[model samples]
Target: MSSNIRIIRICQQCGNEFEARKTTSKTCSDNCAKKAYKARQRSTNVQTSAEQTLQIKLKPIEDIKAQEFLTVNESAMLIRISRRSLYRLNERGELPFVKLNRRTVIRRSDIDRLFDRPAELMEKSRPEPVALADCYTMKEIREKYDISEKALYELIHRHEIPKQYSSIYAYVPKYRIDQLLSNPSNLS
Candidate 1:
């Protein structure tokens, strides 16, 4: 369509003002039009990338289950965590993967197997903490072992022995205390 109507319009890309012959004209000149077209293409490309990323994050595992092999990026997106975390798991020898070029692919089956042995991750049923009655008071540990309070405390700290503190006395497990302080000659 041709028109004699001249309208001042702002270029979408450069924001320059110029007279346009047609109402549909968005840019001032051929250069501005090219720039605007390129800008629009870039915007669409960005939007597409963002949409793909969201889709990857939101996609269900069932949808991806058919695939046997996945790249680090795909596996990370599938697991809904960062690639760094997956890499850490690999470093810790918890998550197994096939290295094709130093770092290549992870098996979907390996991931499934990792989750299958959930017991590895589950906390073992804690045996209830021994009652203070079953444990010797810290004073008793010091006196029985013929050690000073400071030495006894240092030993406990160094050995990472479990102990409980009450209002007046700290209690050490009987077995732990006996194991450390018991004399074999005395037993014999």
Candidate 2:
């Protein structure tokens, strides 16, 4: 059940004439086939790279910048913020927007005006370090409260007791430990 039909084709890679039984044949030898496959892979990769460059990175910035008003998604993309955060800003009335026929439109000028007069932020000063003499070591806390070192650490961690480490020794303010452990209700 074989028809004696021979198809003549040119190698897609090296331009050599070849005889094949199938019309889909493109290359004369295995070497030509490998070369053709590599060329096609390279072409596909170059095309994919070009498509990514054209669509994802460069084109959006140009299109977004050209518009006077932007949607929530476009505004978030332009500012490099999350859509949820932008929506929260709108909810807080921090970022103003206009509604036109059920469309949430943010003006470009409004977005630019956000940093016009930046709020004066003040930094809080750190508290003075507690003197090591005024604090109780882990051994002292354990001896005074009749508790194990492990239990002392767990208590300090659970109550967020400000314990400072100095080299090999850890210290907790005597007053803080006294206030925390002195409370009978805390034990309950």
Query: What lDDT score belongs to each candidate, Candidate 1 first?
Result: 0.73, 0.75
> Tens digit of lDDT per residue, candidate 2, span 72-141?
8778888899987786555334567688999989998787775564454211222346999989988997
lDDT of 1 by residue, 1-188 (tens): 34655688887867889887778898888988898889889999999999998998777777777789888888887777898888656643457768787767999988777677657343342234788888998777767777777567656655556556577566778888798777543222
For each candidate, give its TM-score against the true structure: 0.48, 0.34
lDDT of 1: 0.73
Backbone clash pairs for candidate 2 read none
Clashes of 1: 0
lDDT for 68 in candidate 2 is 96
True lDDT of residue 8, candidate 1: 87
How close to the true structure is residue 110 of candidate 1, measured as C-alpha lDDT?
A: 84
Which portions of model 1 show Cα errors greater than 4 Å?
A: 1-10, 14-17, 21-24, 77-81, 99-103, 115-188
How much does each candidate deviate from the true structure in C-alpha RMSD? 14.3, 13.9
